[model samples]
Target: MELHVVSHPLVDHKLTVLRDKNTPSATFRELVTEIVMLEAYEATRDILVEDKPIETPVAPMVGKQLAAPRPIIVPILRAGLGMLDGMAKMIPTAEVGFLGMKRDEETLNIITYANRLPDNLSGRHVFLVDPMLATGGTMIDAIHYLAERGAREITCIDILAAPEGLKRLEQEVDPSINFKVVVAAVDDHLNEKAYIVPGLGDAGDRLYGVVD
Candidate 1:
């Protein structure tokens, strides 16, 4: 697994606001969309494209277009839903899918309660979006779920990640599965309660308010 941290003055500026507990849900939602759009630029650098012959107003020319078997964007439910619009706007032609997964606070184990994706994702590129990578259990399980269905290449987009989570991903995931993680920042570590420290707290709560 490869990791890419996007470093930009704009990203840093927005992230600071996102980290503030005082930021309202409306503003937080908007910031999440903006940051994801910026990160999508770097995450899709190697996306498959093919040259297409086209006739310009003055002359015939060749331009590039996304290749066949359009990529699929899968957001890991709840918090992940906050990132869907930004990613969809970046690649309007890409297909969309959903995977509902939640981490058991006590066990840190991932529980997949919903799945709405193609039965066969053979050779199709997948982009998995989630706001945070805390313990990495949810992500690791999500990757395995995709791989089981024949997805070989996947790109994971996250707003923040913890070193412990990233390390867990590296040590636990299959070597054969090709995947990369793109994030705005990598925080210091996961606190005892398994939350990224100095990180934006409970992305879902920030974006949609707390749930009982």
Candidate 2:
């Protein structure tokens, strides 16, 4: 499990705005997009590319192109939907998929009611986008589900993560899985309700207002 924290000055600036309770939903949504776009730069650093022959005006030359089996971006629904545009902008050719996963508030377990991804992800790289990694249940279940469908490589992108959640994922996840986590920041710990402390509150609510 490779972990990367994007440490750019601009990432820090936008994250500060996001953490402020007064920042409106409209601003919060846009900032999340921009900040994730910056995170995408580091998240896709080693994307595979192949050299292809090309003609540049007068001479024949070889240029690199993203390899076949283009990566797929899967956003865990609703809140994750808010993150789609930014990641799409970063990898325009990447296919988009949807995974609707919600956490049971009482049990802190994940429920998946919808999935629109390819049946076989044998050689495809998957990027799972969700704004927060709190208790890690949502992500852990999501990863296991994708891997069950043959997704050999998976990367999870989050705006903020709680150390408790990250540690839980590290300790309990399937050891054979090839996975990585990328985030703007990892907060101190999880609160009683499983929310990240000092983290942006209810990312979905902050972005799209409350949903029943």
Best by TM-score: 1
TM-scores of all predicted structures? 0.98, 0.97
Full-model lDDT, candidate 1: 0.95
RMSD of 2: 1.0
- What is the TM-score (0 to 1) of candidate 1? 0.98
Q: List pairs with backbone clashes in candidate 2.
A: none
Query: Superposing all C-alpha atoms, what RMSD in Å does each candidate have to the true structure?
Result: 0.8, 1.0
Candidate 2 per-residue C-alpha lDDT over 75-189 given as tens digits, one digit per residue, 9 for 90 to 100: 9988999999999999999999999999989988889999898999987889999999998988999999889988868999999999987887898779898889999999999
lDDT string, candidate 1, 86-193, tens digits: 999999999999999999888877899999999999988999999999999999999999999998589999999999999999999999999999999999998988
Q: Which stretches of candidate 2 lie over 4 Å from their true place?
A: none
C-alpha lDDT values of all predictions: 0.95, 0.92
- Give every collision pair in model 1: none
